[model samples]
Target: MELAAGNLSEGNASGPKPPAPEPRPLYGIDVENFITLVLFGLIFAFGVLGNSLVITVLARSKPGKPRSTTNLFILNLSIADLAYLLFCIPFQATVYALPTWVLGAFICRFTHYFFTVSMLVSIFTLAAMSVDRYVAIVHLRRSSSLRVSRNTLLGLGFIWALSIAMASPVAYHYSLFHLEVSNQTFCWEQWPNQGHKKAYVVCTFVFGYLLPLLLICFCYAKEIRDDQKSFYSFMPNGQSLRGCVPFIRCHTMIKNCSIIQFLNNHKVN
Candidate 1:
């Protein structure tokens, strides 16, 4: 009886407890580093060249004053892209190459803020450009009479302000953290013990991805619909309208016929 009790106690004590798994390094870290380097180089080269050209043209062009609102928006967009390339790219490239952030907490926080602000600015500028294109193409008459210069400037100001506001959290929350197992450093947001990390991810995706995508889609759809309407208005009898096509026929057939006719006419010459 004593031997059985001892064996039973040993068995109970030996019952499985979860073993700590070996820590694994993040996947694709090397590939990500290479990509970051390439992107940084390209961004630096093109951003500097393109932005310089924009500024030079805007400054020297004597087109009897800037009549188009698009010029201003393009100039602003280039400036934002250049700023991001110059300020953010180098730091990001360094982080990727080293795979460890040796920078102090303050620098990390400030750099993160700059990166986020520039990204937000770029996205918002693209959104503004989409709106500008939609207005120009879809509401040509109304666009002509609009005081676009003043409104565009105001819009740019608002975009920058909003971008700064969105990026403030990075400056506030980012910190340099050391992981002993990996023996590497990371610059990440230091959230409260609660579910702050999840909240941040959700917010980032909603504002950064979802909202921008929806805005771009809405603007593009409007532009396409307006273009189709304009084409039908100019066409005789609206026979060329795409909606008139029978559902059973392939759309490519119509496109192929037009191409074949063009080719035949050219060959005859």
Candidate 2:
């Protein structure tokens, strides 16, 4: 009986364990992903159409005519956003709809580079437009000549150059890598030194955000103080910036809230 018991125990030990349970499919998430993809697709579609309209109108205007400083900055900002809507948004929708990074390695690098550059350009252009408004409002006599077409073009060029310089470093660390375990590809910044990424973040925060924001605040504040004295001072140059009335009004209001208050300041009404 003892020998039989020992043989039975050995047989039990040698018996195959139940096969490991299969990985469960994430059922509910597919529905969520589909919703997300649809929303992004709509956003991408509308953004492309709107930005293209702005671009076409601005680019088609007479070459030699003077572009307003505000117009110039808006044009540049639109271009940046256009590039983003064209490249990044569609790719995002694709990834949300599918399981893999179907756009490939080259696109991984290119998209990130394009995204960073466009973001930098948009912010820089906004800060520039704020400066233009400040100058236009605060130092009307002093800056009127400076706001002319030649200078506006130069300012636009400078903004583009600065954006390129600031965003160029993002490309250095950006790359595509394949994961062995997942058998998948991803875009990531591969900085040689661990601190390199931290350094880049710091730089972007300081120059891209902090410094530009502070400068905008300082300039706009100065404008507010000066603009209080001069109300309804907008003298439209011959060019009307075809499709930019609403855009100009919104941004200009931020810099010239003092001008807005002037309506209340008037006792005549």
**Cα lDDT of model 1 by residue, 175-269, tens digit:** 88899999998886666643665565557557754687589779879877879565323213333324322311332232234234323322311
Model 1: residues >4 Å from true position, as ranges?
A: 1-39, 97-100, 178-185, 228-269
Backbone-clash count (model 2) = 0
Ten contiguous residues with the weakest lDDT in model 2? 260-269
lDDT of 2 by residue, 161-184 (tens): 876777676666666777899987
Local error of candidate 2 at residue 214 (angstroms): 1.3
TM-score of each: 0.64, 0.73
Top model number, TM-score? 2
lDDT of 2 at 78: 77
